[model samples]
Target: MTHTLLEGKKGLIVGIANEQSIAWGCARIMRDAGATLAVSYLNEKAKPFVQPLAERVEAPIFMPLDVRSEEQMQSLFQKIEKEWGRLDFLIHSIAFAPKADLHGRVVDSSVGGFTQAMDISCHSLMRLAKGAEPLMRDGGSILTMSYYGAQKVVSNYNMMGPVKAALESSVAYLAVELGPAKIRVNALSPGPIATRAASGLSDLDNLLSVAEGKSPLRHLIDLEDVGNLAAFLASDRARAITGGVHYVDCGYEVVD
Candidate 1:
């Protein structure tokens, strides 16, 4: 049984590539919990895939946002301000790196590739937090997706390990900066769940298999499992929590 935990809450979800995306999972659960959501797609190529999911969740603001493009981001927030008046929460679920860099040894990664990954995966949260601060008049929760690889070395995880480490660290810093304003910032570190993002990684199946076997539950987590946790963090039930990396990995992080 689910509860209306986010009734009257408004949030923006910035990455929904497809139905299998972790961003989509968080959007679905938050909407089901009675939160009003505004969702975004990367570009025209992605809109067809994301529109139906946005519609399914009844998102009122469906816009295009490429974080690298300040114009697009400004337009998105302008729309939100005009339509919703304020934002209660935001979910940053976007990350990327050149395929060559992702599959190669981090030591050999190109400067361009490493910089791009850090910009997209880590610094974007800081950008969003800056944009969201003013609109969060009543204070709110901000969530960004992360992985175990951020803290521990995982085979085939490659450059993302360092990229996510920076993201988790930013969450802590943002939490402190926004605490006085009552805004909470957090990173949701989930075990590998075979999302579109993970598909880019090498030996994804092996990663999943290893995680399932090592987890205390002996099974990997799914999209909905992550969604359930995300919904909690976004709601008032987690009001006391802020500036931390919350794991939804079924104890996989605890294993030796």
Candidate 2:
């Protein structure tokens, strides 16, 4: 059954590529929890795939937002300001790295590849938070997706491991800086799943199998598992919570 956990709240969800996206999961859950949502698609090609999902949540503000493009990013927040006047939370779930760099050893990652990955995957959170800060006049939460690789090496995770490490660190620094304003910041690190983004990793099947076998739960997590936690963190129920790298990894992070 749907709940009013987020009733009267307004949130912005960035990084929905398809139905299987982690951001899509969060959007669906937050919408069900009574949030008014403003959702973003990466570009025209992604609009078609993301539009239906946004409609399902009755998102009043649907637009294009490529975090790499300052113009697009600025336009998104401007639209939100015009339509909603305020924002209660922001969900950032986008990350990218060149395929060659991602599939290779982290030590061999090139300057361009590392820079692109860091900019899109880690620094984008800072940019979005900057835009959301003013709109969050009453305070807000900023949630970004991270992974286990950020803290520990996972074979084939490659350059993203370091990128995510930086993201988690950014979350801590952001939490401290924004705390006085009552703006909370945290990272959500979910276990392996077959999402489109995860497909980029080499030998993903093996990774999933290994995680399931080793995890205390003996299975991988689904989008819903991640969504449930995200919805909680986005709501006032977690008002006092911030500066954490909360895991929805089914106890996988606890094992050897």
Candidate 3:
């Protein structure tokens, strides 16, 4: 049954690659919760895959946004301002690192690779928040995806561990910085699951198996699990919450 948790709310969802994306999960849930959404696809290559999903949710403002491009980023917010006037929440679920760097030891990661990873994975959230600040005239929540590796050494997670560490840290700092404006920032760290992005990790099968076995729930989590938490955080129900690293890891984060 759909609810009105987000009735009359407008949100922007970034980083949907396909049906299995965490962003798509959040978008689907948020839409069902009565949110009006504006979605972004990375580029033409991704548009075909993402456009259909956006339509399924009835997104009225669908555009291309490469976080690396200031032009595109600016255009996105401009369009949002023109169409929606204000934004109630934003979901950032994008991350990237060169394959060679990702599959190698973090210590061996090249300066270029690490920098790119940090820029796309961590700094982009800051940029998006900056753009969303003015549009959030009535306070808003900004949610970004993070992982357990940000805190612990997950064997093959590599440089992303540090990148995500920075992301979580940014969430804390941003929470304090934007608190006066009533803009909330938080990180959602979900346990391992198969996504097009996660497939980049070496021995992902092993990682999934280990998480399922070790987690208190004895199974890996699905996209809806993450979506439900994301929907709550985006709603007024969580107005008092911010600067937190909330986990939807099936109690896995609690397991030693």
Task: For each candidate, give its TM-score against the true structure.
Answer: 0.99, 0.99, 0.99
Regions more than 4 Å wrong, model 3: none
Q: What TM-score would you give candidate 1 relative to the actual structure?
A: 0.99
The TM-score measured for candidate 2 stands at 0.99
Those runs of model 1 whose alpha carbons end farther than 4 Å from true positions after fitting are: none
lDDT of 1 at 164: 94
Cα-based lDDT at residue 136, candidate 2: 96
How many pairs of residues collide in each model?
A: 0, 0, 0
lDDT of 2 by residue, 1-256 (tens): 2589999999999999999999999999999899999999998998999999999999999999989999998999999999989999999999999999999999999999999999999999999999999999999999999999999999999899999999999999999999999999999999998999999999999999999999998989999998899999988989999999999988999898
Ranking by lDDT: 3, 2, 1
Q: Please give the RMSD of candidate 1 to the true structure.
A: 0.7
